[model samples]
Target: MKHGVTVALLVVAAMAGTMASARAQGGRIEERALPYTPLPADIQALDEVIKAPLTDDFVAKSFTAPDGRIVPYRLLTPATATVQLAQARLPLVIVLHGSGSIGQNNVSQMTAFAKAWALPALRQRFPAYVVAPQVDVRSADYAPGGDGLLASHPGASLPAILALVDDLLGRLPVDPARVYVVGFSMGASAALDALVAQPGRFAAAVAFSAVPPDRDRAVAVAGTPTMQVHGDQDTENPFDPDHAWAEAVAAAGGAPIFVRYQGMEHRVPPDMILAPGWREWLFAQRLKSAAPFPNP
Candidate 1:
């Protein structure tokens, strides 16, 4: 068998046992089960390149929401020389971290997935502002329905997170039409919450292992471009509900790209981050209208 496939099979085999154990102990399966079989060497290298020490260009900042909540976040801007020469407003990408990285340290939220946007080559090619916001607790809420669908709502922290985005848009030369949001696990749920809470605000969104937004709100985000990436074998956030959510979106007249990884668990797929397709797709999107903020 090919090495990658072999490794994937091993991962799936291990997860089956791990999930069984967790269920037996009545424990919640979270990110503590990470470091899933080391990824391919090329992917490993790419991951390292992005998550390496933040260069001097990455700045740490905080935002105070209207509700008086303080949101700590790290912002990455393109090289000063690049920003100055750009004639058009730049895109803004909000990177939300999963629950495992939740904290007030202002640094834990800079997960490898969040840092992918700061890659030197990607930054030079895309040339956008990237912000990774950190919260001290769960940043979103998820309720499972008896009908087997999962409903997602913005947690107390998400309003502040979006507020921070607004604050950045006001002061920075951000192209509202190109605003995008990406997140994983818990953050993934928050990304959908952002979409549901304010429908016309984001240009596009990319969510990984996200619990689908409530079926009722599916129509709200139908117009926005969204891509959901999930593992078929995910136990933390079951795969079936996310799949159902995509179907709901399609039924609501939306075309959402749902990428399924077979035999994988609740972990970020290396391909999603290492490949260039996501970046290409992300940069190609713009809001239908050029409104600078969410429609009130």
Candidate 2:
């Protein structure tokens, strides 16, 4: 009886040790596999839209204006549009790429910025309609000797962009109030120009490492909610211009949110889009009305 009792105790201890080892192995497996999971569903859907197959019909559509200038644009719709539209018309976000991205192959610029902003990833958090308009210098006519003529022609880019927006709105269900615009570098400057030319066309504007338009132009859209993000160490475009513009906008009765990243350069930070606090701050603003109090 004593021998039987001792064997039973040994077997129980051995079983417990085996179970603990199994649990540890399982945990390690989970840790290793979790990172590979595709981003949230909405993000996955957006990424798929970015990577979706394209052809002349699906992309690179060209339109000729009455002035004989040709404008080309690309439009990306959510992959799960049937379901996403059911909830409500998804918000539209117009992404403008920087100067380096200008040319016949403008799609490259939009693709790069969309990926950098993690537009696909953000889709999981917020469903949006993304429109990318490419400004081709080869086709559009510019006034002679204008300083940064390409940069100044918001009319050149704005019409193509707005036409695309209007086309999308006519074809797809979209929420007018949630329309947003985001631009980087040269495109950022163009976004500002757009707001000035057509006041209140967008609900919000986000500019990164951009040169603010002329003060007179900026003041026209002073009431529009705008967010300016720049790195303190940005050499391409000095930080002072952005700071000065933010001050000017605020002085004109617009509350501009200025985010300065210390020890950073011209590139977008890895987690800027996903930062919980920033997201709350972005969604909280009312573009049509007065700006909210400074973020605490």
Candidate 3:
């Protein structure tokens, strides 16, 4: 097997026994089990699953920055918009793909959190826009380093991504009031930093296996309702730093919901996205401020 695929299998299999033990002791990754368990082989097939497009309809989209930088992104419109495309505006969920999903292809990133949103059940219940943008590796080093510090800015894609999001709002039926963000691994770290960069734009966040917080930046976005989930056994991104970050956020008056999966690791089993009303919880959160898409 290829090194990356082999590594992915090992990570998932190794964490399974631990997670099972934790669940037996009442551990949960935010109101749901990891969702891919009891069959190690199933967990191993994640790479192929992630590579396949969740739906054939995700539209190819782009945003051109002022400096002539064009960022590529894939967009999924809900199959059940309430009103006509031009007049309707529903909640929007911005999904950031993990390190493995980064590519110029545009759709590779759609398989992670974005796939969860594409579920037949979720598509019917939480009819909203799902946007997954591809992050290029050359512009920045995405991997968190030795001490769990990311090599680049946590919100490095800030201005460009936000510009794309803003443009989506204008052209598509996206409810500016109900915007939410969710991501795993490097993407998770980026999601949190995105909140810090532009506070009040995103009403809530679900960051899993996220990198350690940029304390100063993290503390700035204390008001946003956020959920942090990590496996104590996560070697890719150590568990303690994320736990401490959530604790610190709460200490600083941010109500971050932290979930420690007993034996989980970096792969984080994307199946958690389909565990009950996870998307609903995200859609329900609303920013207290009246301003739409809060500016930096």
Candidate 4:
């Protein structure tokens, strides 16, 4: 009888130890292996799933402009996007990538900002529409504007982008008043283009590592809520001119929220995007405003 009691106690202690080990390794998820029962069909399915790109996260797609230009893009639909759309139209978040993410393949820009939006926790917290488009143009395509501004006929893709938006709205659901656009580097210039070219279209915009457009276009989108983020020590794009441009926009009644990352270079910082109030602040901007505020 004592031997039996000792054996039962040992079994219970072993399970307790196993439970404690799991609790201790909660944050170190990488040490865990893929659990499998080793059934034939299960093993084959796992192999196939592991080999394929994460389709549930984002999918490669293309759009053709009215002028016959083929613009390749990647679309990311949050798992709850459809459900959220049903209850209330979700906002559209357009993400544009920098020069390094430029390519004809349409996959570079997808990965640049896709991970941030596709994060499981972020997706659950804020489900919305996200579009990342890839452009093939390079340095030569950009035309120099007066003092610290680069210009491009970004209107070229406006048609295709609108078409995609319309298609999404028809099939899914969208909050027309909450449309927002965000971009980085070269993409920032494009965001300015969209803002200027299509005023009253976007509720708010976020630009990173970008200078303003020409002096004339800078004030064209006045009253539009905008957030401009730049690095003060940016060697490639420089900072003095963009800082002045942001000041000029503020003076022109745009009143853009400017965030210059001190001592940082020309790159997007994780803290700026993932910080606590960032998501709420970005989604809370509205187009109708009598008194606009600008932060320096």
Candidate 5:
């Protein structure tokens, strides 16, 4: 009986030690809910969601490029983080704002959706760094692609944005293996540009209502995991092209998950944004060299 009790206690101690090690490594999560949802009425609730005020925790700052262009941004440190955990590294989430939110004030870019990351629930559940960069103009340059659709390339501001990310990684406990970018409308297009611009830098990308870049650039981002969410009824940046982009990326051996809202218009669906699954999918991604990426 004494021998058995000693063995059991040893096992329990080993288990506890393993759990502590996991916590020290930043508690990486791999669970994700369903990725696709088609809701017709979700669009109606966006106004309320958009008007939601941003929390005060996101500290405002500005990044100035070598060329002197300034990009205003808001940064949110993990609510649970502190100076004590010297070896801890956490994921970094970059949020891009739509055209309507563009400005140098640093606060206009704090859309209701962008503010969601600072929510107590989200901060507690997925504590990490969140940065929202505001540019004076579109983050990517757009010109007619000669096929009646616009072709996009990285704009001048993008380099600064990327530099800002590097700055954060240098100064913060950000996990380079789990960097992510997300945006809506024009910002969505910029997010894709950023992903392609720095391929292999981002673990994953989630674009909402984005304009597709030129077909030739599809292969550049073929290895990165991506999710494109858009409403079928979108008129601002036609949905068909974005859909085609997804297909093209898939054809180029890229992994892309396209979420379509059947009867919605040119707007981000509030229901999906506020869903736990969205964060679950975003947080589940980590840098991987293999294909057939995990389905979130």
Candidate 6:
């Protein structure tokens, strides 16, 4: 009887030890999966090259989003002479393209920004880590009005964009405080959706020719600094709601700057992206006091 009791006690102790070990292992795995954590060495090197000097040679790569969907993106590193000699952990800009380029090859969307505005400007003065993620809308359903699906799904395009940011952060040294987002047309709606889904994640967001979402939970993004640019002649998305969006953002205690261009249309003009004072305006704005919108 004494031997049986001792054996029983020993078994209980062993089982408890096993359980503790299992819990510890689980916690480690969870931490490893977190988004903002530093990535492995190989990924870090690749990120550095992406932000390095541009010598008439550009590289494009593809990464898998958290939802297991492949997203193609382009990275243009400024030439060594162009890069700021003192700055480390370069600033990042994530660009979202319009609906016309949605189902097309990622190169079309990438070149639109990379070759158009980002690379040219960076080659002259500022060198930034630019990311253009192509959203594959072939598999996802869209509302009749061309907006995102009303029902939420795991692998939707908007979520895929967010996941792209997570993947980039894990693989690169991105400045959390200086991350910026720019979207056009359908992409503008996606930008607004992203801001609504995750508040305070971006330093600044610029949306051009955009329509406000049907139902935006303002409380989610009360702290994000945003810029709305609309052409007065735009008919597809219109400019009236752009004004309304700015008002709603202000009411939510956020500083939303709205720009209405004269004689502009639904297209994103080069002047809009290359405006002399635009970057200054974007950099000067700061994210301040973000409180939830009062319930009506």
lDDT tens digits by residue: candidate 5, 1-296: 11112221232234323433332343121111222343444444444455656547789888887667898899998755442453646788999888898779888888877887876666777778899989987787677654567767777788888888777777776777888999898888888988778888888888888887876678788766677778888888788777777766766766566667676788766665655555666777777642222221
TM-score of each model, in listed order:
0.83, 0.65, 0.75, 0.71, 0.78, 0.68
Best-to-worst TM-score order: 1, 5, 3, 4, 6, 2
| lDDT digits (tens) for residues 49-151 of candidate 4 | 3444544477778777676767787777767544645675677788877778767787766542455676555667767778887776541125566654554
Please give the ranking of all candidate structures by lDDT, highest first, separated by commas.
Answer: 1, 5, 3, 4, 6, 2
Instruction: Give lDDT tens digits, candidate 6, residues 79-111.
Output: 566464636555567777776766536566643
lDDT of 1 by residue, 117-231 (tens): 6677667878989998899778788886545577777888998998888888888888988899999999998998899888888988889898877776777787677777788
Q: Is candidate 4 or candidate 6 better by lDDT?
A: 4
Per-residue lDDT over 1-296 for candidate 2, one digit per residue giving the tens place of the 0 to 100 score? 10122221233234333433433333111000001112254344444545654322124466554545555666555557544455755566777777677776646665545553334444455555567767664112223222232223354655666666555555555666667777777777667767776676677787877677655455676667676777788787666666666666766656565666666677544333333234433444444442222221
Which regions of candidate 1 are displaced past 4 Å?
Answer: 1-39, 293-296
Quantify how close model 6 is to the true structure by its C-alpha RMSD in Å: 22.0
lDDT of 3 by residue, 119-230 (tens): 5666776778888888765222344544455423554555677777677666765667778888878888778767876787888888888875555455677777677777
Q: Local distance difference test, per candidate?
A: 0.74, 0.54, 0.63, 0.59, 0.70, 0.55
Worst 10 residues of 2 by lDDT: 27-36
Q: Candidate 5 — number of clashing residue pairs?
A: 0
User: How far out, in Å, is residue 96 in model 1?
Assistant: 0.5
Worst 10 residues of 3 by lDDT: 1-10
